[model samples]
Target: MKQEQFLSVVDRDEAERRFRAALEPLGPLGVEEVALAGALGRVLAEDIASPVDVPGFDRSNMDGFAVRAEDTYGASEQAPRRLRCLPEPVVMGVLPVGEVTEGTAMAIPTGGVVPRGADAVVMVEHTRLDGDHVLVEKPVTPGRAITWAGTDIAQGEVVLRAFDVLSSRETGVLAAMGVDRVGVVRRPRVAILSTGDEIIRPGTPPLPGRIYDSNQVILADAVREAGGEPVPCGITPDAPEAVRAALLDALAVADLVLLSGGTSKGPGDLNVQVLAEVLAPPGILAHGVALKPGKPLCLAASGRKGVVVLPGFPTSAIFTFHEFVAPVLRILAGRARPARLHGGEADGARTWARLPVSLGSDGGRTEYVLVRLTEDAEGAAIAYPIGKGSGSVTTWSHADGYFVIPREVERVEAGERVEILPVAGVRPRRVDLVIIGSHCVGLDVVLARLAQRGVSSKLIAVGSEGGLAAVRRGECDAAGVHLYDARTDSYNTPFLEGGLVLVPGYGRLQGVVFRAGDARFEGREAAEAVRAAAQTPGVVMINRNRGSGTRALVELLLEGTRPAGYAVEASSHHAIGAAVAQGRADFGVAIDIVARERGLGFLPVREERFDLVVAASRVERPGVRALIDELASEEVRAALRGRGLLA
Candidate 1:
């Protein structure tokens, strides 16, 4: 059968509008009563009512004697009153044997039942224990120490609202209400597959021009976080038949089948083309999107299986999933978006106060820059960007929330405060992390990995000396630096000698980036284009800002020459390759490993040591300790392999 194709291919926005318009609320998918102890992070399907009154009876909050309020009306500490303690007021949960007349008292313990005739409970601290009876010296008032039945919870009252995601407190509340089980929404099962021959698993060593498969790991985490049960089906070949089989198999057990990679319009796009043919008619709803990074998305409904084809890149995959799939699955599970304060995007307001730290722009697309925020002495919020540029998955890890700068404008200058929307909450606590040195590609990767290990790290790509200054001022927890002392040929230590201790971290490699089959060719001939790139008009040279290890390396490679004034200077290593990938830049300075991943060419440059430095006081912090261990792990070295910096 011939594959079905599209009529009008629109962009990301139109695709979202179409897909969202077609979504219908999942009708009563059924529910299960999960144990209260196991209900944390689960969405409550309905309002759970209290079957019975909490406490069930009038109870004493303290010990001593239960007495009538009228009997002790004139009693006081100085003018104390003594009352005879009655022996028979019945135990808790049992009816009183005999009701006492007024002017009498009975001994009661904390949480003990208050007899029917007693109006209040007096603590034992206020009574004297005599031979066979207790004497009350303090006055008692009606309902002073009594908790009336149904006071804590009313009968058949709604304890938790429907569509509420349960937190630990909610679970505890359910348990307190004597609920053993509760009905919760069913978790949607999603199957994920990483495609492309060039992508390998992290455990596998790279061969020739190949790289590790990180899409599965990242996408899986994002899925689980978004309330889906992710089933990673591992990496598959680029062949259309293999992809088809994987989708069919995943369709059997999953509500959604997500295939990563092979969506780009290159020769590899055969998978997308094949999907159109195989899942045609009532199947493929839309292919390609208006979204920036994840523009080449695919959405289809085949039988009971809904397929979402995401871009192979990590950040794009994450963004698209959050914006699209997450909302849908949450709807299916009867979930509501948690109330958060976005403060909306900036309006006509000019730059407010100083932004605490400097930040970059989003170019044209809607940008999300995760930031760490803190209040100043006057309690005003100060946003510190973890880093700009979404390509590095790690930046998202280190950020508390991203300060949004929408597409219509150009840039937010230094000291110009902006509204930073948090990744988690509107008022996230200030995390203590100090990142120093040049901003390179995927430095956020290192931060992301650190976060997975349970660290609340924040990154600021300050220069080497700049980081040292921040360290001396006690502003950051740890600073990342790759500053080279030409005399000693080492990184960070010399600058931080008096202020902090430099911890040797693994090295990441730097190289010149170009597209494949460029006329520039290889070796020394490649240098001709590389050397003249800065001078060449319309040429974009993505580089780490001055003081970065990458910039240092670039200067070392160019020797006495500077970037030709005609070239465009990009902010980061990933931005460089990204610029080159979509043809924004002709060539840029970045790591060799990334060049291969984005289908770009690499021109080798010098290497530098990326170091993590901590103040003397923070050496014992758990986050820093865990980081040291990770930096020393075989897994990290394996991940770093041939990146510019050395271990």
Candidate 2:
């Protein structure tokens, strides 16, 4: 078969519009009766009204004597009133056998039925038992210590409404109403199919040029989480006949069909073709979507049933499934959409976060950038991009939430505000202290010490300049910086503004890092090796990100000459070491600690003072105070020195 081209490409919103339009007026598949014990997580099909009053009759709320108020009106400790004690006592779940008439009383326990002529119950402590009579010392009022019928729940009152998800609390209410079985909306059956010639089931011995089918496993659980019953359709090889058969079998037993792979414009892409032949009217409403990580997604409908073809990559498949298919499945299963997706700002489910780094986007497609959220010193959210591409399988697991970049916007600047859409119904957890700036192993030591004192902190590595900016904006309690000012020939202090206070951190030796045993850098003076590497032909050098202290040092060393890989920037010292050690680049500037950890050859250039720039207003805050105290502690200082930092 010839390679299939996309018939149409629409933006994400337009694609969703066409897909939902094809399957309009969606609702629950049907309702079914489920026992109360099995109703947890099921959506109620209709309102449940109480069949009878909670308390069938007037009952006693205390273990005391039941008597008319007038009979004990004048009874007191000084002068007591005597009454004949009835032989029969009221017991729980049993009807009272005798009546207390005129100057007579009967003992009744809690939840015991109240007898005729008894309007009140007195405490056993207040009454003294005699041979044939009881002495009442406290006055009694009519209807005291009594629980009237229907007091807890009235008859015919709606206790639970339609579409309410049954939890322990709701189930307890249903049990109290004597509802053993209840009607609930049926969970939609979702058919999951993973198609590819190179796909193999997990646990089947390894094979060359083949991968385990993880899409099915993830999609199945995702369907269940979205209130649908997953029906695994197994793997289908890249053949028209086999693909067609699998598609038919899936549709035969499912309300929705989800197939990953074979939707792109490759020669092996035949799932969309098979869907085109099998789907009824309004088939293949959208063949392509203008979205990053999910542009090849296809949405369709066969009469009332929904069909979706997700991208082949694991991250892409799951992302598109949640964005497009999960909402439809939730609607069909009688569950409401997540409040973060549709609710207003007042919902408390949404948060606005500032990006710590600028992001470049593909202007042709709307991109959703996954981020890890951390709170600032002022309790504001800071979003850090995961930066892993869509093909990666681990990005989704570590992401806290994601923010959207519109197709018209090509870049988002550092510290720009954006609304964060929470993932899996999880909101950003607030932390006690927020530390943003350059990263160092010594900072980790101090943070660990603070943790022992029950203090929590969040650290965002955005280079020295970026961190200082965050501190100036009042977004962070402290910033770690090692900036060297050429004018003053000093570090950190030269960059501090009036409102910022410099806290003594530690000193780290910054040096040129190269692969161990590289003759060009081994056993040479730091200045001589740097000069030799800069002038050497065909020598590639990894550069630090702009605004970092190391970047400034790099520029000074190069003397206005850009190397082969000068534009390729890494954000952290560890990344630089890794690049040099792995042969991605010949050399980069990083801390000596990273060189030692990654087993790279290091030529020390100079020791830079790494200090914390604290916001003066936040210096007295509890978390900040704890962080300062930890920094000054002997244990923390010893740990920092052990990590090759001069404390």
Candidate 3:
């Protein structure tokens, strides 16, 4: 085949369809019987029909008197019906030996076997016992308090379907059905190989120009996360014979093989050419991709086994594996394709969060933006872009998830909502409202009120400026802000524009926060204490981030002077208070609530107004409306009262 055939970079959708068709004939893994105790998280290999009925005998649902239904007719509180009680009460796990005849009753405990000829049970609470004579006050209809045989699970019924992922609930069902062993699909074996001459394995001494083989470990873990058994083949040096030998060995034992690195069109790249030579005609289905960071992707298949050549970069290799490899693994392991919109929430494992900053993408190819989640002091989650390089290891540590920017979208403006697919270890949350900016403890009350109304919200602390910016871009439902204008001697609305609507949030007392026995503030006024702190040598002054309202106020108080630690910044009031409390700093500016909560001394700076800014377009959303109403509710006001944040 000509090299030109492999040069054309196919689109992701086209590549996906081709790979799916190619791997379709591979079929599911062979079935094996596993002990019910060991089958958790494994897919069922076949439908399991119960061999016997669950709770195979008729039983009482409650501790009561089991009797003929006709005997309890017309029994009431005012007018009671009397019956002869049996000598002994039937306890749980004990079967009643005697049958209840006409006008006779027997005490039956919950889950106790029902005696013959008993049609219903009258709750013991509804009856009074008088020396073997029972007075019934209420009547239970036939079959009302008794669970008939086979009612919970019928005999020979299909209790579990093929391809179902078994969890504790399924295990319990199996145990209840008396199935000690269950047929489950064997985990597909995936061979992971890293190929490159410059690649060095982990635990080796660092050498200049030599990179560690991180892709192998990443791919191995990814395969395991997707329910496949990983067989690590280690590193294969970039030689055709060595590559071919590794490929053949992997194919012999692995249902799927992943070769990371050496896929680019550069001189060292040889995975596609070697695959073509080894598999011969009609083996390499697709080569190259129209995706950023993953353009070097290659797909190949030999008989029932498949091979994927992932890009060299860590992020690109991970991205491509999830896009192409995970689905193939799922199919081979007898796991059904998760029903969802393409690139949408997978199996409903998605949470919507507002973008803190604008994201841009070329209109031609799909782009994934790495992001990290942050919660505001009020606990709403906000997502912000993280490191951009596909090879940056920091993304693995910092990012919680990634959101796909569709091919047609040129830019996702700041504050625009985006769907995020979470990283493996991070559990995803469903976000109802994206509230960005200013950290306020008072908002916690609003959150509780919103939760009581069954509304979910996510708060991202980006400071007042960041919140206002997000609101301006329409990325969030609202932004909590406490911007103070020195010129106007006012707060919040001074920074607002006509495109936004401000809803009154609360009033917070800004103050100087210091440790309990700090001498800098001893018997000094708010302004004098601040001046003394500046003058006192070796006293560290913690500051808030640049965009925060508290930082702005602190700057105003200093007036063009640089304190010892003015460059050092904390993101929230809690952080500032923590620095002071832990002796990391002598004093810092924070809200009164934080000072009180941290048991620190406080000196009042100024009371500032905090409010939520909403885009005109978002005011009508149900969550936005609920929040507005909640803020106005007396519950929020009462909670905010005396906390120096009363609305």
The candidate scoring highest on lDDT is 2
Ranked by lDDT, top first:
2, 3, 1
lDDT of 3 by residue, 112-161 (tens): 87776666889889999888799999987766576545445544444566
Give lDDT per model, in order: 0.62, 0.80, 0.76
Regions of candidate 2 where Cα sits further than 4 Å from its true position: 1-7, 69-83, 136-144, 206-208, 337-647
lDDT of 2 by residue, 1-647 (tens): 53343656788999998888888777777899999999988998876767755555666878888887678988899888898989998878887896668878888887788776676789888989888889999997655676544444444444565666776657877877788999999999999999999999999998999999999999999988888999999999999999999998998999999999998778888999998888888888888888898988988899978999999999999999989999889888877532211222223376799987799997989999988777665667778887534532234544668899999999999979999887764444455678888877687677756654546566766679978998988778899998988888889888988989998888899999999899998999877787788889757687887888888888878888876567566667766765576564689898998788767899998898989999899999887887888888888888898878988
Tell me the RMSD of model 3 versus the true structure. 27.6
Q: What TM-score would you give candidate 2 relative to the actual structure?
A: 0.51
Consecutive 10-residue window with the lowest summed lDDT within model 1: 338-347
Residue lDDT tens for model 1, 345-373: 32322222336555556578776656655
RMSD of each candidate relative to the true structure: 31.0, 31.9, 27.6
Error of 3 at 431 (Å): 23
Cα-based TM-score, every candidate: 0.51, 0.51, 0.50
Error of 1 at 82 (Å): 1.8
Residue 335 displacement in candidate 3 (angstroms): 1.4
Candidate 2 lDDT: 0.80
In terms of lDDT, the poorest run of 10 residues in model 2 is 337-346
